[model samples]
Target chain A: MLFSRPMIPIDILVYGIGLAGVAAQAAAGVLEAGRKPFDLFGVVIVALAAALGGGSLRDLLLDRTVFWIADQSYLITALTAGLVTFALVRFVRLPGKLFLLPDAVGLALFTVSGTQAALALGAPWLVASLMGVVTGVFGGIVRDVLCNEVPLVFSGELYATASWAGALLLIAMKASGATPGTSALAAGVLVLVIRLGAMRFGWRLPVFSARL
Target chain B: MLFSRPMIPIDILVYGIGLAGVAAQAAAGVLEAGRKPFDLFGVVIVALAAALGGGSLRDLLLDRTVFWIADQSYLITALTAGLVTFALVRFVRLPGKLFLLPDAVGLALFTVSGTQAALALGAPWLVASLMGVVTGVFGGIVRDVLCNEVPLVFSGELYATASWAGALLLIAMKASGATPGTSALAAGVLVLVIRLGAMRFGWRLPVFSARL
Candidate 1:
């Protein structure tokens, strides 16, 4: 299946979704930074890492021009969101759970995009699925690490699994001759639903207690 | 100043240094993982991250094939080091200071190599210098972050600065028609000496304390 060619004029929709995803990740990054004793520079750096790290890793692994390097819109969006959050953090009192919805949306959207890109690059299905999960979670992992906390995705139930599911669904739809738009949309929605459900249900993975 | 052309038969020397660097970083990764509750898989992954993350990032940014993709020796080295450390952790007791010497050597070797690669790709001296620092410290940053610690390089004094110094020295010597081997050897030694001194002297950058 040709994943690069769009089936319809969904550029605007895709752009909007991508921007929202960036904003969501940036907000989450800023919130994470605020929870620590980060300065303005550190906050901005972490915010950028959270919003862009996954996509950058995907592009790098695929040997493609980094999206932000090619288009300044992503950079501007991420930086703006980060800066605004940093400025308003003192006045804001968001419930911790408020981050879940946007995080799910971002994860879903990035997973679809990452999978499509990997497929277009002729990567194996397994590699594509892994890429999808990497694109969805790497940003959060970097952010958490920078904040000296364990990565939530490592323990968060159904996080990477949701991305893998969405990526597989997209590939399956493509194999069945579905249009790229339909496949991406369906896969993204599946991921979002699963992630939100996990969040709402307080789903968690079983921890392996290391016995030395 | 062609960076790729060898001025002398230093292939064996460079190869040996690179492998030692990889092993050093991998051992450090294993030690860090052992300190945590990481499984074998996590230990291997962290080891790979520490040994290869910097070079991978440099290649990706410069649009070069990832080194490990083109060569398997590095992969084998990192994995073996990690596995060995994991198996022997209970039997071996190491003073934390034991990691510093190997870390310094790895940082120096990687900085010179990263700078040369960037220069060969036609990057400016400043960019190459920054790449050197990135290549030197990026692996440790990944290791620390994955282990849920603040990256030591961020606050560690004279770490990246030493890389920059070495990179600039290499560039200077190259521009003056020095042999690539001479420049690389000298710059690497400078970095190693400076980093070792910093570690021994408890050097650190001033912390930016955010006022609440």
Candidate 2:
């Protein structure tokens, strides 16, 4: 029964990652002209980035098995998402204004995932939190780089801040005796809410030079 | 004595990776421009891909600390390599044939490095070998994509094959009690020899499909 309970959360993470990956890739692919479907290789690359990039970074930093490699589902999911996106691109117009919500969700999940991994490894809190932020954001950074754009991590908006807060909060809640799944859920929700609110409200960070 | 002995090999691996990274970056930066320094960002991106891309993919897949993040020297060396190569591009010209050697060598080292990481993580030998090949070739694939070209990996070359053979050999030797460093060195040499031999002899793989 305990083992079965864990599967519920893991499934949520898996399914969410797959759906978000499809949305992100479809959005990115629309950047391509509809005159041609992205070649299989390119589309899959985008999907993989959108899906696994963040979590992969987190796991590697925390020295844990990458979530995808442990179970083949992530790869198959990304592959399926890429194909479905490519096939359906002609019929859908992605909502440009709300793109950050899924990105935020992925980031939140990855951030918590990274924190959980680091804590499992018995790393210090600072290391755990930092790894979480890195995990949540690194994939998008990579995706942007591969796509020849500057990464979200470097640019404006509350992208990373939202994830960071959720991760830190998850760590705090667990330190105070909260259940793992409940803490993770709360953190994930925080990230999703912050990210969506930021996008919807036009929340912006200060200019690059202002902090100094 | 035991600690120092391990440290000796570790130092060698790090130094070798750094050198190979620099050489690979310089070569890629030049090839990227085909003998010109185009844009600052583009050259740097190519250099980063050449120097760090292989190892990054290896770490991501293996779920290990990214070698670059663990050691900032790799970044410094790559940046320097790209600048120096850009500055000297006007004064030096490499024969087209000579270029293939380092490309193959980079692939070889990357493969061995990846294979080693995978083995250390207790991956199955087959998976380790595949990871090795991925490490050796993925960087160039990334470079080509960023440079807006189809990857050499999917093109008509024995690039991945050389790395794959070298990795399998390394793993076989290691499993039989050969020291890891020695196995790695032999693999690198074998890959280099095979790759260069193919180029020098003008060997090509037979086309798979009858179509153009």
Q: Count of backbone clashes for each model?
A: 0, 0
B1-212 per-residue lDDT for model 2 (tens digits): 32222222466755675466457655675567553435867777787786678778877676566777776667777778777776766688755554465567667777787888787777667667867876776777677666765455543545666777899999999989998778988998888887787666755543222110
Residues A68-96, candidate 2: write the lDDT tens digits: 65644555666565566555544565444
| Residue-level lDDT for B96 in candidate 2 | 52
* lDDT leader: 1
Instruction: List TM-scores for all candidates, in order.
Output: 0.60, 0.59
- The superposed Cα distance between candidate 2 and the true structure at residue A183, in angstroms, equals 2.4
lDDT (Cα) of model 2? 0.67
Give candidate 1 misplaced runs (Cα > 4 Å): A1-53, A65-133, A143-148, A155-212, B1-13, B33-48, B60-63, B69-80, B83-87, B90-98, B145-150, B154-158, B193-212
Global lDDT of model 1: 0.81
- What's model 2's lDDT at B183? 93
| Candidate topping DockQ | 1
lDDT by residue (tens digit), candidate 1, B101-145: 777888898999899999998999999998998898899898887
